[model samples]
Target: MYMLVDCSNCRTPLQLPPGAKSIRCAICNAITLIAEPRAVAPPPASSYHHQQQYPPPAPWPSPYQTPGGPPPSAHGRKRALIVGISYKYSRHELKGCINDAKCMKYLLVNHFKFPESSILMLTEEETDPLRIPTKHNIRMAMYWLVQGCQQGDSLVFHYSGHGSQQRNYTGDEVDGYDETLCPLDFETQGMIVDDEINATIVRPLPRGVKLHAIIDACHSGTVLDLPFLCRMDRSGQYVWEDHRPRSGVWKGTSGGEVISFSGCDDDQTSADTSALSRVTSTGAMTYCFIQAIERGHAATYGSMLNSMRSTIRNDLGSGGGGGVVTSLITMLLTGGSLTGGFVQEPQLTACETFDVYAKPFSL
Candidate 1:
């Protein structure tokens, strides 16, 4: 007996004999199986087991679960890697970067309750050869952050150092510039570009895990290559824009969550030794962020953003502190604004703006 069938892989029509086990399509040169139905229904646009455009369904509900749905739970784990490069003798050295990383580690451990051992620190003063914030160390540390990450895991990647922009040769960046983080060996090994950063941290993550990147550097907006940049009005509404039109930048939420906060716009620079405060020195943005988080106030994305912005404008004056960074979360009861108005902006890049039933921000 003979039968007519279409190739499942290439979708080409073929003439076949009964009991044929497999066939090869001539047009697309794809092999397809002729077998009994294993799946009850056709998969969606993509399969969870395989990689595709939109990520596959996650195994658990995310932080901001839909209302009345199952509550968000921590089934995986939490880890962090904080890198602060002083670049001691380098021409691009700064004073406040190491301070920023240490302070953030304090906040995570004392306040947010992150495990001390789970936190990795890479700085210039490290005696261990492996802990130095060189290009190789930073890259390895990034892998360590997301390695073995599973659903409900929370991870933080904080970088405080010299950030610069290079001419975009790869077309992955939309603004014709590729943001870079200068490691201690940047002069020799070259700066780590945004593309490499994304491929390292964002692409490998599975759904349900959350990554929060607090990038306190120059030209850091969209540094992680997150797909959606969230814009919020002074009132309460928000709109998300594609970070790049032609680029297929990876979003962490394929089966996990990724939200990156950058210190400034791609064309602008973040301040290091700000003249605003009485302290020795600190990244302007990092200082304000620490202050806000330390307040122990219940923080949502909106509330935290306003608190940081407001604290800076009030104490530092306009442009006194060049620290303004933004992040993305699913949803919470965040509805507040900075009192003093300024054009100083921070950028928030999310995966899909999944703002339905998320909870308040925590560690």
Candidate 2:
């Protein structure tokens, strides 16, 4: 006799002989035990077996323990890649991008205590041929960040430069636009579309790893393409909105703790300004971002968002687009309209909603 069973790893169904102790799934190639079927009918088809998705070669132990165990502390390896494109001398010359990249490196090293050597910096100023922010270099850097990542490892990717949108041929984007990152050689090497970004960075990520992205660029809200778009209210309530079902190879979440802080909405443009202190030029969103973290040290997601909005309103005018946010992001981030203010609203997108109140700002 034979019984139908789902692959323990990838969920593909297969037939198994009676009394078989175990079998390897041809689909995901995962070895799994053959257990008796449930006496009762299986739950709804929608029911999930998330653990089955993790194939053999059990993941490394997490750096953190449950609240019942040790106090909160980060362990394991940490790595980051900071990409800033000045686009100098090109038709799309951008000022302050190199500075943005350097500042981010500084923030991670000084504030987050990340080691300097572990972090990769790709900027226009770099004379090294391999370290330039060319399309190839950027992809390689992303690969470097995810490589050797273990449970509880921390990985970060920061891109401060130009972002553009193209017609979505794959139907992956509900808005019919595929957001792209313009490399220094984009005119020659082509743009890095969100699909490539997702596959390169988000797809291979294992559970228990932490990937944080700070994208200071135009149309960067979904740069990392996380599955869930979480929205919050002034009252400090949050709701997870499902990412739009799209065609082809990319979906946002990877079941890992992936989060992004983007400068603007898909239909909007972020600014490169030096208005904050008049001391140095940098991206407006970026300036407020570092400042908020520096001042608050540790604020809830809601508090951080509020602090950024308040800081920009009180200090600088809207950058690039001259408006606060596109209607899509305004509703998504604020759960309301832009009101009368004109300021670019930063966005936080994640794989899933966790304890927003408890998770600190820097993480």
Candidate 3:
């Protein structure tokens, strides 16, 4: 079958014929060899014993290896709990958020070396029937994230769903606290306040723990605002636009060793599509994110933020485009002290984006 291939050398997609062993892009002059899948017949029921006789070898390094005989204080191994809620009660398309979450889980497991057991997946089928990711599930997930994390541990919270915002409770016009995310069970009469979410999740995080939150929903652009936007002209780089600063607005917790990535500006609404397949439907921001991290562009948290912004800005365009509008923000808690005598470095290698258009798959 034909697969959409993005050239790591050129970062462009090319279409190839089905069953073709190799492909060469006419535009970029890049060549990619396709792997052919080998067919294997299923064993009969009586062959179960034969299969058991030749078990596969154990995976190496064991995702839970302690570096150099478990350092003092038993700094626990890094852990992650991924919650992906894609299917909405009122939506027609298959929620790609779930697919995005699963893809990240694969990256975390394979690339980041996070143990598979540490990553949790909460989909429509696995979600609790009684306590959906409504206010209840979000709260529970927060509890698990904050209380569950320990000093020297890093946690990542990625949410992909519909996000909405409202005026702050004080109702001060100049205050300008204009955006927030909407949970599964948000109602106009009773909205989920950002304060509640911060109080429950952000504020209570254990000291010395690094937290990274990625909110891939709408109305999240307020998470962080850049001082200005620059454009590269023939002469040089020039400042083109500046996001007007709004004073007296709440900027979440800044001194808590936490960073947030929001989806869109308060005035903008994120696009959720139904026509694209799950693997490819991840918002442009997320799609670019996977590409950047895998392609070795991002190493540190700060660097990751820069790469993410640049990719979204360049690939999706600034003002009007069919992509997710996302922003990244980081707040330090206690200025980051080494609580466990060991600092963990995030591991994210490089890989090209999986281009769907060139592939034979369809929605």
Candidate 4:
């Protein structure tokens, strides 16, 4: 005497045993109660059973909500982890890196609908005490990137700090040496090398995930006065230095897919204070690069970098400041190829009749 039930909402059919009192739909995840004709529970003697069959209240929205609501399509969202090192203790100046990161985060989240949980931020005050070998706050970020990153996910690594170089290790081939990122607690006794960064975050990333690294420091063969151009393995040692590269371009042997955006060139100093009101700025190049992207002028990475270089040169009143903006961005595309999508797609307003997607940077 099994009772057969069918869901009216999703139209999925279900089977309930004679004694079964309730059943849930398999398609829409909705619940339905099964009542045997003779086994129906009577309402209170004075109450009407029709009142108990009232409709349910509407459900709330999911965490992943878009401008109108949940996206009409089931598209994998743009996931990102942004880190800005604006304030440092022993490290070099990073006046605007953190601010730049914050702005970039806002663009990605609000404009692109990237989940708030997906974005990670690190400042001078936040540090992971347990992970001593790596940068203070970077360890948590690395942990999340390594474990959570999936194929097809896009990752953005933005750092506004000092960059240096060291003689290539015996087995290393490219560039005859390697570039390094100076962590917050980097000690002169044992410099933190870029290899560690690669090992922790870059190397472990899942396949099909697009990796973009923006470095707003110097790191050519030689920085201002410090000879980062040619040096021995000083990974564990730290030297208080200035004029280092902010970013570099490289890939893993297994075809590591990565693109980097550098702030300045190797020999020049990346300006922290801007000419625009001297109102502290964040990763100079990073800020401008994002501005172009958010504006929708950069349909590709190459276009975005070109726009950044032009804008920076115009804004700062100089063409070459030794920042690594172009080099880092070009590296992401493997020596220049278009990548990056138009974040916002235009739609007519409730009262308007024209397409605003063509409008200048709708997002």
Candidate 5:
């Protein structure tokens, strides 16, 4: 006798054969565990009289099992690691990083339904020493985020802090520069380079899993070393430019999906400013990203990116009005400007190319 069950990830109905312990969903390829069948009494004649006959359940093999072997159980899980380094009492200190982490946590818990216990946060204000956003601690947290990840899992990594670029010695970087994330003790411990970041979080992902990285920092574009970068113009026309290394190195996921959103291009610097929210300083990119989602403008990836860029442009005086003059003055007073120019554009990179306008955006 076969037992009826639902796929753990896609919720597709499946029939488990006798003696089968686990089976893979034919639709989503997600592995699901099967419980032993229990005896139940048949329905009464009146109950059957009102029911229509149904087709027999489709036969799907238990890929994990052999003729007489037991199979292991697997289920998808969601996890996140959020790191915000304020570099307190230092020359490179930031005012809004910790606040960014807190806001992100709130959004994930309240909006996305990520369990509080599954989300790990590291910030300057954390009371636990292990939770401090130090170089070692951050690396370990990255490992933990993807550790034990299986097919159908969803993972996220969010960083709001200082980011920089270092000269790339390897032939992997097309522009000959590697992006980096600055930890609290970066001056002593050295910044986390893009190569290491990719190796740690991006490359190990398996098929049917997905990762979304939100980086609100300067020089963060391509920070995860994803292979394709989505280049869009002000008119919303876009193309996915190939960014694979000429050295033939693989910087993509292991059949899983990886997408990244950053504050600016590799050559530009992001602003830490109070212009976006007049009340307190915040990473401009972080502010706009949350706003895009909260305001119901993030139906697709293209829409989300466009909304973020438009908000930043208008807030920074590019839209043309008396409001522009006011924004310019406010930004100048706050010492918030991109290095080469006042422009800061958010960037998107991914392991694979897809239709940004057609693909629905989700965490």
Candidate 6:
């Protein structure tokens, strides 16, 4: 007899073929396993005739369970990929990128409770060739981050490096340019564009999964190509601007939740400076992002964003003449321009629209 089962991923009901132990859901393409019924206590004497006439339906197997599964945990599995490219020996070499990677890894392991084995780091200090932040390795690492993700999974992708833009030929970008991340070998391999980044990590995300990206790079406002970009002014009034492509391409997640916090807007460049800290130089955005979380200012998304902006603005200062000079000097040194006396406002983008104040910020 045929058996009815639900898809493991999408929960669509399907009919299992006779004698088949498993079946694949056509809608979500997830395989459902059929299990044999286990013996149970017989019904009471009063209902014995009814039980015999109609047997109880078999129970659906748990997707995460096995014949003898491991003990349950307090939370779902968490994974992260932290990449910091210093570009040693090159004119574009950065000092604080590797430090950012180390700090981020520590925060994830200590504060967020992510397993050390599950966190992947790619930086210039790594001796392992596979761990080096090359164009190919970063791509592979992105795939590894979301591989086998399931319900209740929390994933993070953090990049601290140079970012640039190329003209958008696909018409997907509203500004006619594609944001890009500069890998260590980007000079030779070409920069990894935002389209590819979205396809790799953003598109395949299934429902019930959450991805948060921290991008401390130039022109990274929409690095992940999320559909809604939050436009908030100093007054704290905000509106969600729709950025859907006119090409009819879908940039939103596949029922999953994705939120990105970037260093600056698409037209602006992020700062790499020693001004924010006396101990070491770091990406302005990364420093403030960590500070907001560690210092207990991140109760909600709106609060965290406001805190980051306030810190950056106060530390960098603001003046018309000084801002122009700072921008010129920054361009000469880093090959990018800054705005408002080295001010780099953090931006928030997401796959869907929600009230930032109401949604509590979590890993």
Best by lDDT: 5
Q: Number of clashes in every candidate structure?
A: 10, 4, 13, 31, 0, 0
Best by TM-score: 6
Write candidate 2's Cα lDDT for 1-363 as tens digits: 456566576544444667888766543457878854532222321222132333322221222323355554445667888999988887898766877787788778877878675687889788766678987678656656665466787898999999999897756676788789998988866788887687657766666788888899899878777776766554556777666545434354344578888887778788765423333356767766776776663477667766666655655553323333323222222321111233567777887776766777655
Residue-level lDDT tens digits of model 4 in 7-112: 4543333446567777765334577776433322222322221112212211212223456654533334444556565435543666666666666667667666
lDDT of 6 by residue, 79-193 (tens): 8889999888999988678767877887888789886766888998888776889876786677667666767889999999999999988788889999999999998777888
Q: Mind giving the per-residue lDDT tens digits that candidate 3 earns over 170-247?
A: 542223574555555555224445545554455444446666566666665533222222222222222333333344
Q: After superposition, how far is residue 246 of candidate 2 from its true place, in Å?
A: 4.1
Tens digit of per-residue lDDT, candidate 5, span 170-192 = 67887999999999988877798
Error of 1 at 238 (Å): 3.6
Per-model lDDT: 0.65, 0.67, 0.45, 0.45, 0.75, 0.74
Candidate 3 off by > 4 Å: 1-73, 89-94, 127-132, 171-175, 187-191, 222-255, 272-280, 313-363
Query: Per-residue CA lDDT of candidate 1, range 94-121, in tens?
Result: 8779878887887787767776767888
Q: Tell me the lDDT of model 4 at 319.
A: 32
State residue 156's C-alpha deviation in candidate 2, in Å.
Answer: 0.8
CA lDDT for candidate 2 = 0.67
Q: Write the number of the candidate with greater TM-score, choosing between 2 and 3.
A: 2
Give the range of the ten consecutive residues with the poorest summed lDDT in model 3: 329-338
For candidate 3, give the lDDT: 0.45
Candidate 4 weakest lDDT stretch, 10 residues: 343-352
Local error of candidate 2 at residue 220 (angstroms)? 0.6
